[model samples]
Target: MNEVFARGPSLLTRLCIVLMLSVGAMVIDTKVDNLSTLRTYLTSLVSPLQYIADLPGGLLDWSASRFNSRQKMLEENSRLTNQITLMNEKLQRFVVLEDENNNLRELLDAPVREGMYRMIAELMAVDNNPYSHQIVINKGAIHGVYEGQPVLDDTGVVGQIVEVGTTNSRVLLISDITHAIPVRISRNNIRMIASGSGSLNELSLNHVVHSGDIQEGDLLISSGLGNIFPAGYPVATIINIVRDESLPFASITAKPSAQLDRIKYLLLLWPPDIAPVDALSPSDELTREGS
Candidate 1:
């Protein structure tokens, strides 16, 4: 131990020398600011190291705060959860309102039929029968919905109401096998019957001869023959035509213009002769009498 101490400066002497050197450096820095640039450079170089060294302490402090406050954390989580639920509900309502707005805009842009009054109705239920194309609407006799009343969308005729209850009505789609409409060729005004083929996308033009003027891509419009559907509304387009000498009638198929299976809202039309008369309540009658 004595030989090692003699080789280097004693521990007390080394400590005194370091203390004196530190005091001299601090006095020079305070008196003349000579070490300012050096101090700034050194701090800039050591800043990254200082941050790295403090990282563990900072992490420990963060963990203590984060895991220790169980009740407070639960309360904050619940508050955030409630806010999310409220936002979701608002988003749903916004979606519904946006759809309704679009439907109304389409209605406003549609051509108005002369002498026909229109009322909007919503679909309530769809018929599950794969063989039938029918839908039930929320409107009924109470809302002046009657049998044979025509149902139309923004594009064209959808169908006619076949059954009416007190608060609901059933509509037979134009694609139903039993349904038929008088449609005229929009190209030449040649009138014919368009019968449904029980297929959602197809209609049949019955009795069309081989020499008939109908051709593929010819548009069919309502001819207003049966007084059920109005004239000038688009109905279907001829998609296929097959003619054979053995068959008396040419086989013609048309695709409907209206999206019958995808429609969500419908318009119910009232003919001039079937205009609804509002039932007067007792108060309304008494007020009318007084007036």
Candidate 2:
């Protein structure tokens, strides 16, 4: 017992002394307010550890943003490329249309006989019949388009209006088998009749002799005798000529000067000699047919 109690003070006395020291330190900190600087120093010391803990998450967010930006740029680039390609195709078509417009303007500037007038119309539809080459134009009775009105392209005569509506009209191409036009030889003014052969590129001449002045490569133009088409318009070019002594007439074939299958725009002509009263009213005919 004596050895166990040999320490400087008993356990109870040592505990009381430690409590007193702790209370004295608390009082000094509260009354003097001297520990705030020490707390700031401690927080500064811990800041690097806090940053290290957050670094992984920050790096992950940055990487994801970078990837998304690259993907968006690629998509934008592809869209731009497609737009450029479409624009280029349209530009090519515009160039071709510009050239055609210039040629038609030249035709418009040419002097015509008194009281002759012209208007431009766009092709609205083409006939599906293989044997009949016909087209529809965007002009009708409302626009003064009447049956038998002459139609022309940039190069030459195209056809005549056969049926007219309020806003659209149908044309009977010169290449139709039932169609015929009076033409004359440009070299000698030798009059002949040109009939369509149900072929887009061929027209036949009627009652031509083997010894006639016409030959291959002769240019045929409208003679103005038919009272339909205007005079001096290019019609066709003679392509072939055959003669047989036993036959009364020579076989002659010519190609039309106008590109009927390729034209997109045409001119509707009004001739002075073709009195408006004499021309059939398309609206009246359509009404009769409908009835």
Candidate 3:
């Protein structure tokens, strides 16, 4: 190594000499205004080399942009497909509404209910209890659904409002064991008490007269006995009446007028003013207190 060093300068001394010369040139270019033209010429000469150095990065960025666009297009297509499916479902529901309106108009002229107000509400949920037949409606006291207000549907009377919430209400159906509504024969207006039997589609008549002028297939409508439900709204139909000479009252069973198993929407009676007549009527109060 000493013989090599003696022959000439070492490799490290040669690198340091080259570095010192490059730094001295940079300092001279920056300090001397007369060499500005030389610096500009050098910059222009190396511009194309700088462009060559940046080419690979630009190409990679363009490929990445194209890949992102393909992914965005796929996501946009999926969103459009879901929106179209939802619109089609809404269109089919409109058709059902049109048919139901036509039927209601026909019955309007058949000497049915008059001067009655109704609002459409969706059935939000049904209670999971065997003892109580309660349902949740999307309408509430905010929408004029007061406590004890009558609830019905196109087929028949379903229940009455028991609990009114801010935006929803709970209804106790006539099938509940605790619910009772005053009813009577539409043929002769013989008043009686209709009690829930805990069955989905049945109500039992309490203290029905042996000759109450009711027969199988007879439509038992809301006779406005308590005046809570509007008069002439179908409540049930006489299905069976078992007479027992040994017992005081006959065993009566009636099928509900409404489609209890398949009810999706309901009509909430929203009158201008609700009167709690059933709660205050002498006969109804007496029956309740007695029970």
Q: Please tell me which predicted candidate would have the highest lDDT against the true structure.
A: 1
TM-score of 2: 0.56
- Please give the ranking of all candidate structures by TM-score, highest first, separated by commas: 1, 2, 3
lDDT of 1: 0.77
Against the reference, the lDDT scores of all candidates come to: 0.77, 0.76, 0.71
Where is model 2 poorest over a 10-residue stretch in terms of lDDT? Answer: 282-291
Residues 114-162 of candidate 3: C-alpha lDDT, one tens digit per residue? 3444455778999988777999989776666688888876667788998
TM-score winner between candidates 2 and 3: 2
**Which stretches of candidate 3 lie above 4 Å from their native place?**
1-114, 273-291
Residue 110 lDDT, candidate 1, scale 0-100:
75
Collision pairs in model 1: none
Write model 2 residue lDDT over 108-210, tens digit each, in one string. 9776445345555778999998877789888888777889988877667788999999999999999999999999887677899999898887889999988
After superposing candidate 2 on the true structure, give the runs of residues whose Cα lies further than 4 Å from its correct spot: 1-112, 272-291
Candidate 1 residue-wise lDDT, 53-159, digit = tens? 99999999999888879879887765554344333322422423443465558799776545455555777899999989999998898888888998876567789
Worst 10 residues of 1 by lDDT: 282-291
Models 1 onward score TM values of 0.56, 0.56, 0.55
lDDT, model 3: 0.71
Candidate 2 backbone collisions, by pair: none
